[model samples]
Target: MTDLLDPVSPDRAESFLTDHFQGVLVRPGDRSYDEVRAVWNGMHDRKPELIARCTGAADVSVALRYAVAAGRAVTVRGGGHNVAGTAVSDGSVMIDLSLMNRVDVDAGALTARAQGGCLLRDVDSATLAHGLACPAGVVSHTGLGGLALGGGYGWLARKWGLTCDHIVAAEVVLADGSIVEATEDDHAELLWGLRGSGGNLGVVTRFTLRLRPVGPVHHRTGVFPLADAAAALALYREFAERQGPDLHAVATLKIAGQQDWIPERLRGTPALFLTATWFGESAEGPEHTAPLFATAAPDAVLTRLLSFAELQALGDHGEPHGNRYYTKSCYLTDLTEGPVGQLLDATREIASPLSAIDFEYLRGAIGDVPDEDSAFPRRDAPYICTVSAQWTDPAEDAGHRAWSRRGVERLAEWHFGGAYVNYLQDEQPGKVAEVYGSARYARLAALKRRYDPENVLSGNQNISPAAP
Candidate 1:
């Protein structure tokens, strides 16, 4: 065994790793090392000592065992889309699962099994081909593993619940280099913890998710001038509270850019945008979305029936890879005037044109799930507020981050003090407890102790092992 923290002879390490590993191995000076290390967020620029491009569960187990024997820190990468960039670390053993992307859809069973590296698009393309869909994140390029583990929500959440809610089973690689299948009947507690506690207990090699029959959906997008944003938000709040499970909506405050949806006059101006989707009849969508148009009298309105995959793809353009991204978010108990005003004030001083304040309406099926069903605890939150700062210039990082922090602080009074763990960045400390309350966190820690006693998997939103 070698000390992973201390410097070891490269020739010896490379030879040893090559003798034991079957997948592709890249050392520090390898030609593709830089490309392998680049994740979705440009904020993290780390150089791992070794990169193991695992092909399957066997490869993952081999890598983990080797890392444990060598006493090296390990990080896992699946689609490499984490905003916090926990997938890569300096001088660590990076288990790159990007090559393991394989999706198998069983229409007969109404379920889909995806490898750990499969992105949302990979699963969507396969399942949608069969006219079936799974609840997943909005961004098509995001890794399904991280999103599902952190409680996935998107256009279909109101109708079918979160991505984690639909997960029937998962194949996980435990810390002790053993593989196990977690389902309702076997290793059930571990399965419950995996629903929302993030990549804390172990590395999931594959996920088996329940699928639902989904067809074309009615989509409505409205853009209103900044002057009428407050009134529009109030109307939206009222409508969202009373809306049915088949309808899902989002309110966004952003500097209108050159998007095709935005009218020419609204471009480059501060504006409020409302987007609503109806999973049922197309005719009913306009009825549910009429209140937004009546309130804001938007400059432009685009409503049409679109395929489910197309609706999911819409989020891809706004959030592209290689851009510096920072986010501050909280789950709001309600959307009252005070918090709305604070959000507006925060948006008034936007650091970058790409920056925006977003609100996602939550309830219906999301809240129907009991609090103790999974590690995710904030089921009663009616909405979630996020201040997303995106910029291309590295020099402007400080201003943008500070702006987001201040925005979250101003709206703290209206929030439940809990945040979506998936959206959390590296800078937010002590957030694990907030995301999962004390009782739930304690339960997760106990599970962590049983599955990973030494805390070998501490690269993610970690839950420390409970004391004996």
Candidate 2:
């Protein structure tokens, strides 16, 4: 990685920016820089000398060329939702993509064109109008660029695969300032590297995503009372094993104050909120999965068939743009007893009032994809676990972070030692290699060397060439 600690001074930075770009160029003293530098997480306090709000790919290329020529570090900012605050840096050229929020849907081809800056909800809202949808992040405000590049997962994942799986092509600005379109037929190797590779390759300006016809579907949600955290976890482990592609479900042990839907008994206790969505008829899904839920008598049942749009909206309640949140996620091949016990035991000790332990079932369409076909190699993974700790104060940040880390440590003994990069926050850089696995990590690093040899886009879950 380049030395980003000492960027060019503000005068030179503004002068270089003004000479090449016609869009807004903000500096430290500018009133807009304060707001522009503020990312999704209020915890970050970076002071980039310049922030260039690019108007299009041409402007992006210009910025990239300038950063390299001047030997300056550059950080790309989409929705800026990365919990690690990778979108901004202390002394770097912040390429703000917020101005590139545009969505174009091709109804005939069943695809959507999303600029790098658009959020999940932006694409969903546009595609749903045409009775179509694409796999994206669960949070509505997450940037399409960062999510897709890092292999996004959501409710539609089990049915349609991950966001990277739906990508048809992407327009990327390479290290030396050239623009290229990467797809299966053209720049195929780069396309393969782009998926699940984070932003180590290049700055993706736009993406052509595959879309599926998602009509009205059955949405069954239940909040089970948690008299026994161990029993609830065991039941969830069993239920996830039998779930099919049509059924997308997650079990979250959340704090009482987060939602009113939680059962009174489980309100302030360690409980499970199992939400399932089936794309087909409500009756069929319920009948197929009824035995699983029966394992533990649920205190509240909020199951019913609703439109696919409504189910997407249900998760919208959790805002993606703000609120101090720390998360750790991992993929597992099975819910072994030892790991399951450790998970339940860890959840019982959460000190934060806004923390939660979540289990997202991974099977069906997601599991059907070949490991080497795209950058995502976790097809064999049956489950993805996440510990999300959210709060509203800086003083409470350390406590929540420690709570999440402890959960990860407790579950580490039982896991396969792999994780989901998109859910990683404030963890070691080595976690990047752990998430992608050694063999695949080497391939990703080589690809990173080919496309971003200078490490121009090193702000993300970084990948560099292997040592000689």
Candidate 3:
């Protein structure tokens, strides 16, 4: 193995990756630099020293070697959808994986191998063609690399579990430029770390995810006036407890938007939205969704039956690229009166109409995996509260970021578990350890020491190799 921290001259960094790399190299002044470096969150405007658009795992290994030898901060870019904008660091060598997007599904085995650069839409479209699906994040455009490596939640989460759970195997490039295929029989611990610990351990080049049969599903949305939210919540609590494994439900509070169902006068008003999906059979969907439409005195209501792939794309409209985004989230032991009320109240002070707060009920298949089964923690947490800030003006950046933080801070009393890594934007010192607790963080830290001892992959939701 080569030394991970050997310092080569800065002048040779571009040449190093190009010498043996089978990918295109993008420079700062290159015509495509601006476009290639752009991430989903408009908040990040980083200019990397070099961009290696890797075509395969071989290119990933070489990119890491160049970053290591050149002593540059190395960041990896998949779909570039992370809210934290960790993909492009200042003066770093970006291992760009956007060109490696290719999904190969084995119809016989019911498994799909997606490259690091694949977005959720890439995998969803591919698997659905074979009449199979992989449970993943709600946004179809979300990067498979980040979502699978962190923890994925979606309409299918209730029946199939998180996207990370389906990742049976992966090709990872270590800090020292060594490639390893991680599966049950080889580097099993590394695979565990990849399951939920973020990409802190290594650069995952490809993921083999197990697939299940999925098809057209049911979806319903009931919008209630903010004043009547308390009553809606009470009904939702009862309705949620009665849900089966095929039912996935979520409650969102946001400013009402212009839609046919929503009266023009109520368009700008704050309202509570109840949405549900039944992933079983299209014929069986309405029965599961009836209660969602039963809420008394809803301001507006709409229901639809669409394919699982289509419902996944539904959220894409609300979360478009080029919006400045920041998020703060925490896992709740349960969604009780206190936390729910507080979370709802926090939304009233939104800095942007695009901002929204979501309360997701966790049930069913997610708990099927033991806490020790993978690096993902808080499997027992019953709810996750996400306060997201989305706006365009950079002048109000501090205020928006602070609002998101304060929203989560107010729930500190009810935040019984560490946050969901996928929804996190920032955490104070010692918080990363809190994400896994002492035992699991220690295990992950030890593994980090073995694979990325120099902490070359540090930043964002960082896991220090040093003993926790």
TM-score of each: 0.95, 0.92, 0.96
Window of ten residues with lowest summed lDDT in model 3: 1-10
Q: How would you encode candidate 3's per-residue C-alpha lDDT over 1-468 as one tens digit per residue?
A: 324335546687666655678889999889999999999999999999999999998888888888877888889998899899988888988889999889999989999999999999999889999999888888888999998899888778879899999999999999888899999999999998999998889998999999999878888888888888888887787788678898888999899998888878778988899988888778888888888668565777788989777888999999999999999888876667888788778978886899999987896899899887799998888888888899999999999999999998899888877888877765678887888899999999999999999999985588999875
- Alpha-carbon local distance difference test for all models: 0.85, 0.77, 0.87
Q: Which residue pairs collide in model 3, if any?
A: none
Candidate 1 — which pairs collide? none
Regions more than 4 Å wrong, model 1: 1-16, 427-429
Clashes of each: 0, 0, 0
Clashing pairs in 2: none
Q: Residues 206-254, candidate 2, lDDT per residue (tens digit)? A: 9999999887766656666555555766776777777777777777776
Highest lDDT scorer = 3
- Model 2, residue 118: what's the lDDT? 87
Candidate 2 vs 3: which has more lDDT: 3
